[model samples]
Target: MKKLFLSTITIFILIACSSAPTKKDEIKTVKVNAAIGEIEGLIEEDVYLFKGIPFAQPPVGELRWKAPRKLAPVSETIKAFSHKSKCTQPKENEFILDRGVTEGGEDCLYLNIFVPKGNVDISKNNYPIMFWIHGGSNIWGTGNSYDFSKLAESQKVVVITINYRLGPMGWFSSSHLRNTSEGDDRSSNFGHLDIIAALEWVQENGNSFGGDPTNVTIFGESAGGHNVLVLLATKKARGLFHKAISQSGYVSSFSEQFASEESELSSAKVFQDDIRFLTEDQQIADYLRDMPIKEVFQRYKQADESHLYSISPISIRDDIVIPKEGIYKALEDVDPSVVVVAGTNKDELNLWYLRSKYFYQTALNLGRNLKRSEENLKSWIKYRSNIWRFTGAEEPLRRMSKSNQNLYSFRFDWDEEASTILGDYPLFLGAAHGLEIPFISGDYSLVPAYARPLVFPNESKEGREYLSNLMMQYWANIAKYGDPNTFVQDHRWNKFRIQNQNYLRLDSPEYIQMVNDPVDADEMLKTLESDSTLELKERCLIGWIAEMNFVEEMRGDPPFDFCSEYTSIDLLKLRRLTEGRD
Candidate 1:
């Protein structure tokens, strides 16, 4: 009689559970077993957010300047609702700091995950994952700075953003820090290693969060895009990701001094000398490893702005993570099956020129009158953008296609009704380098202070919303399947081929179409040369520097080999002027 009563109670419980409502079941809270512990995340409306989830052991103390280590599993639960401290980076502009944000810290190897409501069944359903890497020239910026809720909810996908080491902390190479006793004692590019570790964590934990680990897509813009290429070329990252999208990605090579070998003036050497001068010569590595965060930050800040670009942050071709011949040279070795979408904006360089206080000062010097300065700046901006698209986008895509890899190219030309602080925004900042980021992520708050008011005004709300939705769909669609055409029913985003040189000209609400034989760089340069008001040599060097993110590529061979007249001094002057120290 007692056994019969227990069986009846069990049956009643099962029946109640089966009959419960399932549609949009209110998920006030959610839980998932991730890397370190069982994470308790919050469910607000239709989105479930898990922020500040640690993926690796803190690279502090002895681990400083070393590869990340696996984080041991814990029995405790983690309340992952708030963002952790960002990785150590320089203080941002005043507008950014006014938000009461502190500078980055060393213990910042966390990631944020966003999952839509209906796709939270790890036991059965499989949702696509988009891993994001933030871009700030690899010097500054954090993954937590972005909000991926809209993109995740609108398209049933799992979105992730991560924080990796930055600046000297990320890419510094030191002879003392190299593992001399090991089989291979190469150092530098710890940031890249951190990214690899993060992806590995995803591979292990993605399924627990209702994501298809096998269908992961890595996408980034600018520096982040560059990293995507690095991962693409990396042998260890071969099976880690299936697809990649590099927005306004530039190809660059690092020097032996920055990566493999030591130089008299390398970042490592300079810091070592400073430490010895302050403390002592013995145990340089120990002293550096144990140095106070304040002192290290001070030394890092003392580095010359010019040297930071020209001498530092170049990844060493250790033949382990990155090859000896740089990414472009190493691309032939990457798996041909990996689908790639690479492209740049119509006016990538305009953002730099418009944002530069130095450029504004130069315009004042040249104009002697406000209107004249603005005109010359506009003309110069257009000239620079054209050359940028040619060398950075069109040429690289054409060259990469020779490797027989599946690739597509695009040029974002949507600069409709963008009038900001500079006045006449359309002509000045049309489809700038980072403009596509806000559109794709549906987070307009990431838009810069100056451009925010003008580009996203109350009147143009409809257009902005339309463009954001469309771009997000394209991006999410690509992440879901190998092709973006599977999502958009109205228009087919043609696969970029060397034969036709086809590309999608992304505009919104009315004008997004495919075109061939875009702008000609040589012709644009000729026009700039004829303009007696403009300084031809400075214009050429400025355009080149702008294309390469203010860093002049001095390794291997000269970038603009066609332009023979510009001297090293001319390039130096351009750099100083751009930095506003001149």
Candidate 2:
């Protein structure tokens, strides 16, 4: 059955591929001179589709994470054929596509485009563009993991997606350590800078491919969503994207790795843990700085496995790349002109639950105490709720979606009956989190056909078509008019509750219901905050954690002070009072 499904989907895709317009019929693939390089792409259907376009110089050899340099111009007609290399992966424990699917390197800074077929007679294809940033917790995922064929075929819009550096390669920080000696400020957000470089490339060169460089919409799910939000907050990204959409990933609380004190502690811990592997103590910083990236990368590649939330990146210290307090202040001062669309899955932390079950039970049964797991589970809950809150509040003056920023929120409860991936925990983790992925990407075999997200399941062509149409339409519509309502395809997509709200709830299909009244932001957030605080039951066995040397806080970094202040009776600061192996 699986073979049949794969065969069918393969055939379906090949059929689409065969019919795609060739260079003869496709004007977009013209052998034109570009600012960066001379390349040849195909005019597919009515729009030009460019594949394997390099936005920056390959970060190979020593340039890895130094910063993305411009790809030198190729005066010859370069066939921009297959996907560029994928950004370095964050050591995966599971496989998504295939065992062979595991491939990446430093030279992975390439991007792809799928423009809707349109006017061949027109001199320039000025269609509105949507730039997709793939989400993988800034780790293991790719643009190829998704297909934009449906969007291209239906919306007639231009879509572009890119692969960026991941894990330590993408976000390792060196600032705020009180060391300005070697001075590399851009190291932390080099990945983001890569995206900006891509945008600059698009703005200067997208006209040939039928994209309206001035009208770009940036949207992403999970880590991609957070990246989009961050882009919206950046002065560098201003005017590059007119609107933004963030799904499933938002700033609820500071990700532990992004916290100034915490990020430093994490970086220090990785170095300290690996000290024995080093040849000399004094040369450690110089050696790491001067060593070839491929070597240093190998050493830190599997290092994240030793930590709790491995997908998160340690903060780049304060001085060079981005200042320590810049991001928080940026969110607190987001511009009002940027249109915003944000929401979460019916099960936001689905994968976290997966890790919890696998790692938690395995450790507990082995009598190996798991202290961090207890706190992480709670942090996950707060993180989920914060995605909604951050979109609504933070600043009354700078807030854009005061009910009109075209904000749409939905709870994705497609497969409520799906069993928990864990050993014992069931019922509580239902339709829980990330169950929507297969459906979201239109890949259902990964889950039971019965257990798929509603919008993109195979069972419902009508549902898939409706979702594809609605999602693409709303997205395209927002891109076109700062609003997301298709006269023929969608309902009057209403704005979410922006005045201290719980966000609009999508109870079922065929409904874009109005939020009857505002939800007290304070209450929902309180529940979230109260629930996110660490509890004693999870930490009851880890009695020696506080006294352990590894548990010390950074010099200025406050401990989980909010956890100390939590009002939830269920929460217990176990590390605070318990002093022994209780």
Candidate 3:
């Protein structure tokens, strides 16, 4: 569930001030701080955790859709014990964030923290700090989902989780919102600004909580992972995070026109052009900002459930924040000094293709409502664009995916059918998208089987232990040394290399493989990405060409069944070159 609160005020001192460095905080439950204003905290052994503590003032009323400002200082300590209520949204919204109307208020700009118990000399101790940004397509998810107390207690590091606005509340970008200050082009990405503010708060106050602000690792999954990239490239977020980890996050592929005016105007234009009819054909620009929030969302939802098409803007690259729209530029163009660990799951686009309601509709050939079907497919294909996502920039994207290859190239294959098929008819989830979360967070009970074994009996006991150890090892490795490798790694860590397309296969008992790379992953992707791109069938043709020699028996044979004669062996080699640094 997505949450929206950011700060809480409550006072609880689990580890007495007089105590020197000890193991755990004496108290077992959460402790809200009076200094930071009552934020909630929980004790999982020796660590005290505060969940949903606000770092900035909520963006509502006058603050609605504005860049988040520093949190207002209160004279009294606020209670920070429970999960801050989230904003209003539907249950189906899985951008990974949710704001239940009843859950939170406009004042929800909080962050969560975990402090090790009975520790003194905390500053010089240099305990690594991990700041987690949750992924939910930028519109769903809060920071409280994963409890970081164990990580804090075991590693003796400070771990923090934070909330940023979502949907129109968070990522509605454009050059629309005027800066109360002069000549500010940051109008479009206020939500991103909110994240930056939270980081700033950490830098300033981490020491007070006995954390080393200097050694910070900013990481997240999906949209949160994407934000890490955004922060990586943005001049604003530079140095705020010394290291970064992006899991299952890819570059936002939007045309120049789409990236021009903050993303919201694109939505506005789409609304004016088509969505007006639903609301008696109101002008998109005139009505969107003024209409009741429910009506505005209702009108947009009615027209199309997919937020990308017609109106919703994806990633905006103005001079201020995002210097470039894609991660390719960030890696190739930015300084290598900015260390990163970027990896994708085994089936990167599986969720885009499989989870799409459009695919289900197409598969069943159900003559559902045309508008609804069209809207659903529009959204589906947009993410899973045969050209944009797969063919058009496939090779380049793959190259980008493998750009930081020297770093750990991990593929999380933890399978859970129940969670993936939350509401789907076909319940076969083979290492689906976002499956890495439970593994990384060690949340095995993610599915009905694990959470409630009666319905999902397959949440085996072995699986739980495997997931728990895997997540802890991976996180601890990165948090300890910016490197995702451990001294006791069960499997040997592999780097992205040209000759061997090796990725650390993270399954029960570690294994590795030097199999064939996606031969047409780039060329087909490039072709499909062109303004005048190839059709899906055309892509299949090109894909067939690339895979000509990409057979399992002949792993390195560039001339396998999928590749056409017109395709060159050099292209495959080029792909290898791009995938591997040397």
Candidate 1 ranges with C-alpha deviation above 4 Å: 1-27, 93-102, 119-123, 179-185, 258-265, 275-282, 305-311, 357-375, 390-392, 418-422, 448-453, 518-533, 543-571, 578-582
- Per-candidate TM equals 0.83, 0.70, 0.68
lDDT of each: 0.67, 0.51, 0.51
Model 2: worst 10 consecutive residues (lDDT sum): 3-12
Off by over 4 Å in 2: 1-33, 42-48, 94-103, 121-123, 175-187, 252-265, 272-286, 289-298, 301-311, 314-328, 354-413, 416-459, 486-490, 500-508, 516-582
Per-residue lDDT for 223-305 in model 3, tens only?
A: 77767767766777877877777766545534434634433335544345544464432233344445555644554454443
Instruction: Supply every candidate's count of residue pairs whose N, Cα or C atoms clash at under 3 angstroms.
Output: 0, 16, 80
In model 3, which regions exceed 4 Å deviation? Answer: 1-40, 44-46, 87-105, 116-126, 173-185, 253-267, 270-292, 302-311, 324-327, 348-406, 416-427, 449-460, 497-501, 510-582
Any idea what lDDT model 1 has? Answer: 0.67
- lDDT for residue 188 in candidate 2, whole number 0-100: 64
Per-model root-mean-square deviation over C-alphas: 11.6, 8.9, 11.7
Highest TM-score: give the candidate number. Answer: 1
Please give the range of 10 consecutive residues that has the lowest summed lDDT in model 3.
7-16
Question: Deviation in angstroms for 435 in model 2?
Answer: 5.7
Q: Rank the candidates by TM-score, best first.
A: 1, 2, 3
